[model samples]
Target: MSLPEVRLQIAAVTLAEELSFTRAAERLNITQPGLSKQIAELESRIGFAVFVRDQKRVELTEAGHVFVRGCKDALALLEKAVRTGRATQEEIQPLVTIGHSPYVDPVLVSALLGVHLPLYANLRLRVESMFAQDLVHSVLSAEVDMAIIEEPADSPLLTLVPLVTEPLYVLLSTDHSAAHLASVSFEDFGKVGWMMFPKRANPTLYEKVMEAGKRAGAVPVEVHHYVTPHEVIQLISENFGVAIMFKGIAQQLERNDLVARPLTAAGLQVNIRLVLRADQSSRLVNEFGRAFLKRVIPQGQQAEISGQLLLKL
Candidate 1:
């Protein structure tokens, strides 16, 4: 058996967060001395002091920070395992939540909803909408079993199943100088203006665009942030600025003098992915993921390749 059992790990993690024996013990509904003993046992078993304490204050050791992070992840995984196992044992229709960013294409979302698996006929899906930034946290915390998002931050703990890879498109007024061109570069945006969603909506993609603009010397004359495609349409109609977005979004908003043109900025591609926890162990959830990939593969040959590549990875 492991020396630092779940109880010891919990104690260490709590104490590490609180940095106070009294508070940690109270939170755990244990005596301060009991908490101390558990931490001592953990340190002795692991042969490392996770905390430094004198009379007034407590602090994590250099190694303690790393250990505590691992403890948190381990505890989260254990909790998920218990919940998933209990659901499988008790529920006739085990619910799997699938969250998505509001910006995800409607076609892909429809594809996901259309998937059915003969082996897991009782599996049910609950869909939720969130911004891409929050979707990442929701997936990592197991709030949702998986997420369909665009341009999430890189994490080793996540397995990103790429669903679609396409060039970003820009929505500009028909009267704009670059409107006649089949493709516009970020440099064109520098001369005009740039309108996009706020960074909070999708920090990774927002930063990527900003970085690309910097690399291309395409500094925008003015910057505007918008929340919805309708707002993008309004801004473009007024000749406020050009909005850069995924191809689907641009195409959807192509009307009323708004035109969609591919952005020729290198490395500025839009990547839509189905994100799953790398450590997911539930058979039902894994099967649902496979079913989803299988369902979307029929959309195109590129989609089939994406599905096969996801399986290979």
Candidate 2:
């Protein structure tokens, strides 16, 4: 087979991992039409149809499934040979690149790197910040070694591990009347000015927030949209608008003048997950994951335990 044919096999395996062409295109860093053309060329050479494409979604045929398994094994062997060659020339450190969503706990990243830094001082730990969808795509494509995303992506090529779940909170200026209240309901703040991230950066959260507002009979007055959490909090502190954010974000903010209260009416929680390629069997990845779980999970559980202790006291 030609070099392009081999590359096409890798792309097909990735596409099989994610059933959607749109997502597969994003993972491959190619346009949708380009990906389709490559797939067509590969099929023509192989003389068999690989995907059953309908209007809504695409499904792999039985032959496609078998071919994907073989391709993955071949890719792994080729990668190993390359790594072996590099190791003979120099002591090449194994790198684990991780991607994170804006909502992910920075502490988790810090802790993960901290544990592995001493053990493998030569190893490199790189972190990039992006939206959940992009982070998931990066992990599936092996662009980054792994990712910490807000929610799991619907892909068979990646394995998702639940990290921690945190309650959602509404952040407002301390001077606001609602700031003094222990809790606020959506009904009470229906007409209030609000700040939110743009739909592109946070599609899942944006949709859920809009849906929640509708369910609570609130018509959100968008004072600003597509603002970062740092900017949102700054605006709130200056009394520009109110923002709904995950509780972890509140903990990270150094501004003591801002108040974050539980939104009793919203009743939404955000889940943080660690995503890595299903085929990856790297020791460093597993070590990093374990380190994060060891540090963050206990802290999260302790908060719950402390709350229960206060009730008994």
Candidate 3:
């Protein structure tokens, strides 16, 4: 039997993971109908239905589970082969892909970019910016060697090394009642419109923000979802809303008409971290991580920095 096309294998694997045609297609950058056609062609070539699908949901058939496992292994091996071939070229440096959450502080990104490992002078680093959850997924899928992201849910397959921890800040108009305070309590803005990124951006952080507000006994009169810092800035400056976000984000978008005050609510902090697969075996990638961490936390202060860092979520 002829082997299925590589794209077909990828479509099947992604569909298996997501089980939602809409999402899998989005990940593949293909239309839903196009993805369905690929799966159909793959099944036709293989003489078996890999997925059991209906309008309501999609499920992998008995054989699909085994097939997907093999596909994942094959894809991983193909990736390794490509990397090995590239590294074997006379002048090519080994490439390591690093993903970062868009919300993470620029200093951390700058620090990672500034790392210079003595042992791997020819190492090449590529960085991609994505949402926090997408970074985790990319790491798991081997699309990214490592990622700097906001704290995500605990996963046995991943290790997280905390990089930065700072209290969330409330952004509001200078004329707002709480603008005069050095720090604002959640209660101060409990009755105003609250603006935040949609849950899809970072579900864990989104839920944490909601839970934090509840614990502080402060719920907004209405919550507005925003997709960009500029939008948040616009809304707050126009006195249409207020926001709770990381200090770094607030600082980056600071404006004369706006003011940011540390949010004094407990458990409302943004924790940036370095996340990598627990089973990582690349010496270049591993050493790069060590060198980067050393740059962020100097040798003599490792012990002291450990105490200050939020080591766990």
Per-residue C-alpha lDDT of model 2 across residues 1-313, encoded as one tens digit per residue: 4334456886788689889889887665445776798899888878887898988989999998887888888877766764454344234666767788776667776766676545667777677998776676566546676777774644556666666776667787777777778887677564677777666665666677778878988886665774467877667656666787767676576366887777775536676777777666565566666565556566545444333211110
Once fitted onto the true fold, the runs of candidate 3 whose alpha carbons sit more than 4 angstroms away are 1-61, 82-91, 118-124, 298-313
Q: List, residue by residue over 1-313, the lDDT tens digit for candidate 3.
A: 5689777898899899899998886665445887899999999999898999999999999999999999999988976775565457313566778998666777888988998867667867889988876677677667788898876656556777767788888888888888889999878884788998777777767888899889888878788887776688777766667987778787777678888889887777778778877766666677777777887865775665444322311
Give the alpha-carbon lDDT of every model: 0.77, 0.69, 0.78
| Model 3: lDDT of residue 250 | 75
Model 2 — TM-score against the truth?
0.69
Candidate with the larger lDDT of 2 and 3: 3
- Give per-residue CA lDDT, model 1, range 1-313, as digits (tens): 2557777787788788789998776555445776788888999999999999988999999999999999999988877786667466525767778998766787888987887868766767789998885676577656788899887655556787777888888989988888889999887764767888777787657878999999988888788987775678877777778998778778888876778999987788888888877777666677778777776755555444544333331
Could you arrange the candidates by TM-score from highest to lowest? 3, 1, 2
Model 1 shows how many backbone clashes? 0
lDDT of 2: 0.69
Of the two candidates 1 and 3, the one with more favorable TM-score, higher being better, is: 3
**Model 3 residue 220 distance off true place after TM-score fit, in angstroms:** 2.6
Worst 10 residues of 1 by lDDT: 304-313
- How far is 141's C-alpha from truth in model 2 (Å)? 1.4
